[model samples]
Target: KPMTNYQIPQNTLLKFRIFNEFLMANERHVAKEVRDEYVDTMSKIYYSYFKGYSSRLTKLQYEEAAARDDLMGVEDTAKKGFFSSKPHMKNRSTVFTLGNRGEVLTTELEAPVIVPHAAAKNETRYSFECIFRSLHFALMDNCCREFLFISDFFMVSGAGSQNLFEAIMGKTLTLFLKLMEDSVQDCYDSIGIFLSAHIVYRYQSIMTKRNIPALDRYWDTILNHLWPRFEYIVTMNIQSVRECEPNKLGHIDNRPHYITRRFAEFSAAIVGISTTYPNDRVNRVLGQLQAEVENFILKMAAEFPHRKEQLIFLINNYDMMLSVLVERTTDDSKESEMYR
Candidate 1:
């Protein structure tokens, strides 16, 4: 059966719409606090969706599991009920016996459910495969925030967990690289593929430095191979798109924004700026800024003079707060702040 496409919650969708509207609006300024609040809510929504999606395996997963079991010749002994208990050879203790007829009774033992080794192996393989597939789709689906959250959690939980995660990440990257080649052959967005791959690779390289030192060597090799190949593929893809959609090529967004570099950059930039780090002082400052302002750039660009003054006041106050927290003796002049 085809899996039903689970609809994202209506309220979440509404908030997303409003967020995009506010973020992209040219005429009106959205406050920084408003933007941050919306983003927080959006993060929660995406997390909820990711959790739900991971918890329930799709029909494809079930099919794959069954196929794997069949290939492995895995049998469930409990399901077959093919068990017989044997009595002790000596039959040490006998039941009551009569003079004419004697009868010995033995208690029947129940067979415990036994899982075949092959079956257990198949289960483990299926679980890992499903997780990789889910993450792959999640990345492509623009649920990268959720992917980052899950992957980070998995990496730090324990040594065994980290090893399993890195292994699967490697496998997933290899598969994606293969797919990227196929996509290029089919005249798809080769540059986009390279870009996304590099982004993921860079992040994985950074995040796994402490846990998987060997992966750095592997990454060096991959990057060396990727550079020249990426250049060639990107050039070819550009020419192809240019020839195919002459007038609609370059800056023109013929289809959805998904095919454009600007959209990808914008989305990534938002995540980078909005995401909180582990550092206590930085988190506190960023959190405060997010709480106070509704829209940073919009206010700067607003026509109203008072709005500009408000932005200045906010910045000065923020700088003063930061200076006190850091206990730095540096000048807090507007010029210095702007340069910094």
Candidate 2:
């Protein structure tokens, strides 16, 4: 994660360049055999560095994920958003979105038991942020520089250098993407993937500033790759709620329903994440989700036998949902104050 402060290797490529230059300066022969040996040695350097780095990066992600208690808990934490985590650049102008104050909605509003929706409860996760940071460090930051180095060193065309780089180092990129795809395909929590996309998108600005036009397609490809899966997950969630028949359950509880909590938590989580990094497309999705949740609440409220009971139940459930969002308030903002 650009989310975590995990350090990545720096200046390691510079050392490789120094060694290559040193070898070239000291070489005693320029015969075919000598040139072939030199090229072979350089090939090993590129291949070994990238392959080794890729494995380490992937391993680090697994380790961090396992340390988390569970995927559901992770999603719960994310719902509050990461605004307080501090932005990457404090120098950039900052704007804060205020959150509503959670009213005293309960005579005893202890932690509402989160009866999680029917989703996989994975013990560990392959963090999207970790994958994003690691692969990005290797490809855009590390491999980009290394590829340029190979081109200049061997006097190969940029295209040829790309092929050479892929032949040796492409396995790492493939592995990273495959891992991301597999993780997202079977993700227990989507908020992580959702926020991670923003991380990838932000790289566009970095790529522009660095002026590496050739590599822009790589990140774009990544976003395109995960996008469909993300949308599918979001769609499945909305569809589930849309098609749900709350009337079938022949029970009425004055307390908040599990589905209600799921919706509330989901809404709050995305709002929190989006508050820090707002996207129109994501907001549109949130809007749809919010609408479904409201409808669901109305339907759920109708389950109660009495009009007063139905009204009270709706209030309780709405308060339950509102409390989740309100607790995630930012310290400086004018927006929520108007509604608060």
TM-scores of the models, in the order given:
0.22, 0.59
- Please provide, for model 1 over 24-101, each residue's C-alpha lDDT reduced to its tens digit, 9 standing for 90 to 100: 465234543444454455445445544444434322222222111111011122112235343211112111111111
Best by TM-score: 2
Query: Model 1: how far is 6 from its true place, Å?
Result: 27
Reference-based lDDT, residue 199, model 1: 40
Model 1 weakest lDDT span, ten residues long = 101-110
lDDT of 1 at 294: 22
Best by lDDT: 2
| lDDT by residue for model 2 (54-132), tens | 5545543433221122221122233332576532222211111112211111121122211112111433223445445
RMSD per prediction, one decimal? Answer: 33.2, 12.7
